[model samples]
Target: MTDVKPSCLEGIDANGTDSESAVERTGAKPAEMVRFTATPEKNGATVESENASQLDQATLMATRPNGGWKAWLQVACGFSLMFNTYGLINTFGIYQNYYTEQFRFDPSRASLIGGLQSFLLFFANGAAGPLYDAGYTRLLVVTGTILIVFGTMMQSLCTEYWQFILAESLCIGFGGGLTSFLSPTVLSTYFTTLYPLAQGIAASGAGVGGIILPIVYRELEPKIGFPWTVRVIGFILLATLLLPVLFLQPRMIPGAGRKFIDKTAFTDWPFVVFLCGNFIYLLGAFTPFFYVEVYAVQNKIASADLGFYIISTMNAASAIGRILPNFVSSYIGPFNMLLLSSISTFVFAFAFEGAHNVASLIVVSAFYGGVTGLFFALQPVVVIGLCPDPKLIGTRVGIALGFISFAVLASNPIAGAIQSRGGFVGVWLWAGVTTAVGTGVMSVSRLMKTKSNFFMKV
Candidate 1:
């Protein structure tokens, strides 16, 4: 259309070809206008209109959103990937049930195991952003699959707490983090204004996985034992994601080449505020992901099935939470969407404090999970809003997430310690307060971006 290809993948690929490649044909003279009888139809024309509709079809294709067959296929790949990684990760409650019984570890100590896994997942993704920008998607995806497969295989042999620390916490954490960061970047690079929708679609994979994996593990564990049950899930991930990598393209303009994001991009004020706010909000957000179900079991109000369901339900709700708000956001603005989600999260945390039964607990899990799910889906939009350069996007998000992972690292142990001393109310109240603090920080961060201006697009 513009004689320029899309820059969806911010960093360009080095080996791509265009008309310029004809110069190296090693002929004495190069033809100025190459033509052939066997040439395929130009990209945009519909068959019915033939030559007459070529320009019009080109314009329509140019204006199409990034949800082409390839892009959505990538989203499906993410769904399969996330289902395996997140489903297993959220099943910490399932693991925790036996972990305590088998190892005699206290809740506080066990929280560290789950906490460390989550910390690596989020924090390591900070680095993953840059690696992805350096043209590493295929590599990371393959590596992640290998790590997850090997980790699952090795985990079946574990007998001690530290074994999980090595196999599950570190291996799975690094594995998922690698895919997690790249998956979003891949979705965003292709989808322009429709990024939030695409991202919501991709992010929903984890939610589906979270919902299905717990049920799968729960049903299968009793019959097959933990080792084989876990190993079987590993193969499923390999099966689903292995083929799609071939169809995917980086979407960079032809002839453009890959380059790392500049460090100067990180110094922007809006990005800095985003970093801080995300750290505050996410630190509190991750606590429930890792431990809310464990709280249900510890409080003696619900059975172990309910504990597993807490996260499972939360994950299910999160899928909706991530995708549903996108339509409203197209009108209201993503920042507004984020602000409302943050406030609702704070409210949900407090609501959690009064819960004592399955119904109340389910509501808390669903609502809170939904609120946080929105945060993840749109937070990247906030980053892109602040800094629009594709080459620089990775740096800004990487740095922001790196800081956020610190809070992720610390949130659960804090929750576990509080639960130890004062039970669910104490931990939930702290979590609620943290959410409010995060909301306030995120709002202020936005204000800083707009020179104290509100209702600005970012």
Candidate 2:
């Protein structure tokens, strides 16, 4: 057999040779050939056409490393980003509790700051997705790092409600949003079979960071003072975020011409209903993270110091939850795993209402965190699975997260308002009911996709 060059056309090449002869000699099928045309520019240089770039992506997608040093490195970068983004967000309960005690702010009003910050932390993804798809991974990460560091520093100097809102809510929220979702989107390009597992590993960084930051804040704020403690956090953000800014890589073509709202995604009933369930669940999800410490302290279930660690405990279990369930999901299917996780979360939401002692609260926190961790890890996997075009995953994920931003933004404040009139029981009951409804809605999506087969891997 002769070595033959695969060709898009069967006629003569630029070299005036027979293209069909080249194809026949190598026995290369038409589908296996690299598809592109080279056109000469005015400078007598040859440039591959846009079709070449598209073909390059398809080729890379099929052959991309599922796991290797390079691929796993992105996971590490993702972990670091999550450590800074959701890690800190998970610790917001500490801030809420602190502001309530020190400043005497209304829980409902103070929650607005956290609500705004959380809002942009996800909402920014709408714009960030298109930017990531355009190959601005480094730019987005670096800019987000700068803003996060700046916001932390600014938050140190803040003494007023509006000032905290400006620095923490606007600056940090937008900054973190730009970086937070990009890791999963990037990982989707590198891993196929191991996508969920890789995402879980990366997302666990939030759990680890969540566990540590609360301890740092609790221990340091008393000794170093609030401003200096916040500054310490700023320095940590600067250090950790530098890794992704330095080395994170996007594996797709620079421009796929995606829109922020994929109108097509909304038309798919399964996708629409699934997002609605996610929306309702999110409305209750972070409410616990923002209030567990406060609940423990106010109810005298634990000392203030011990109460703070409940957040850490939840996050530790959450780290385990993020990793193990996702590993299991690789075999069972992400949608199936999501349904199970949703049911568990719904159960835990109600279980919190029954806990009246220190031990019971801690147990509830652990179980709740673990289940929510699974939900967070599964988000990207489910979105990618639903997406018809792999190239549009980022955009579709961004749109889905836009719904989440509102859910989180309104969740805490609503909980706070509910707590003001009725107490934590009202909050707990609301969380449980919403999660239950969300679970039921999500079941609809699963059933629709699996053709109502209860045991399908779907």
Candidate 3:
């Protein structure tokens, strides 16, 4: 056997003195050595020396995220992206009302248009993610900005059903997808410890936009007509998108050789389980937002103006929901927060069935908004945790969201069809059942992750 020398030890020198002896000789307290120690029986002196060198190199190469003004700026840019993408999607009820009233389409047809928009917004991300990973983030943002502005402007001139579908559903939806996919993915690179809080603040911008845009449309549409009101909204998007163009950045250099779709991620069972649960959860996720205003009008719970306010009220509550739950989620894992939000959403969907008056309607809307906000804010973080490689986060998130987009696409129109057959009761019951099923699936995913450890943060 080779003899072990003090010089081969992690915290020893060529003088055959270890750190502890040196400390004592110099009358100094022992300091922790930042090196790996290897057992003599397991590895010889040469192997131990190599292990120590490898550990030193790893320490030198490791880089923690730089959280400062630059990082928060990325958060702000993420806020702007959410404001334009999900913000508008959340307020589709306002558009659905306008289209059915103006163009004389049935509720299902109107819902179909909104659902198509949501589908594109989510599905297009599959391509956008790979593009971003390949170093096209700037291109994606610029192209998306142009399409969204152009599409929104074109919407002002549309009168026919096909025209609206082309401008609103296809162009704007595709544009929103480009920006939305890049925003959170880039923001996540700037944080590890404070990720949940950063994402929550970024997502709260959607709540703020949801509250403001509906009120803007309600007040503007009456005075300037639908055409100019839409034009005004388009201009606001132009102004807000500038922030992302200027400030949104990625820390990793573009990996041009990397494939857009990472096939390896498919083998991660935990991630696969999470994706299945997410799809089920999203099936009923937006049902309330899409139909709540119409449901209120149908049930005589509120007037037209008050029905509009209901959307805003829910979004106002969502602003609080987005921030608080995320901050708390830092202490308890994101999956725990997601499980709680899923359970609460399941309960509140049932509350919609019991709502007969304006008071109960508003209460249920607020409560549902709060829980859903938690779902949205924590979603990206949960996916990040399951990801094995940080470089592939964009691709993984994009593909998962692309699959979930199908559920979002079909949900609203399905809810409308159910309402047509069974009235408001049918809609509420469908929403409740789907949400409950989603909750159960999510619970199973949690169990799979933690092996039924009820108190584990994961």
For residues 1-458, write the lDDT of model 3, one tens digit per residue.
12121111122332444545554554534222222232222111111122343232112112224367877888899999999998877767788878888889877788777788889999999888877766677788888889888999999999889998999999999999998876667766666557778888888888999998888898899999999999999999999999987766665444448697889878877778788888887888788887888788877889988998998888988877888878677667777888899889889988898989999999999999999998888887777666655556678889888889999887877887787799888887787788788778777766776667787775
By TM-score, the best candidate is 2
**Tens digits of lDDT, candidate 2, 102-221:** 988887788778888889999998888766655566678888999999999999999998989989999999999988998788887777668889999999999999988878888899
Tell me the whole-model lDDT of each prediction, alpha carbons only.
0.66, 0.79, 0.76
TM-score list, all predictions = 0.81, 0.87, 0.85
Error of 3 at 331 (Å): 0.6
Write model 1 residue lDDT over 1-458, tens digit each, in one string.
01112222221222332223323432312222221112222221112122322222122122223666766876666566666565567767677767787778876677677778777877777776666555555666777778877887888888888898899889988887776665565565556556677777767877887777678788898899988888877777667667544433343211123343446655666667666777777756776776676678777868976677677788989989889888676566667688899999889888877787888888888999998888877887666656545545555566666677788778777776787798777777887888888788788877775666565554
The local distance difference test score of model 2 is 0.79
Top lDDT prediction, candidate number: 2
Winner by lDDT between candidate 3 and candidate 2: 2
Clash number for every model? 1, 0, 0
Q: Model 2 Cα displacement at 393 (Å)?
A: 1.2
**Model 1 segments beyond 4 Å from truth?**
1-65, 253-262, 298-300
Name the TM-score of candidate 2.
0.87
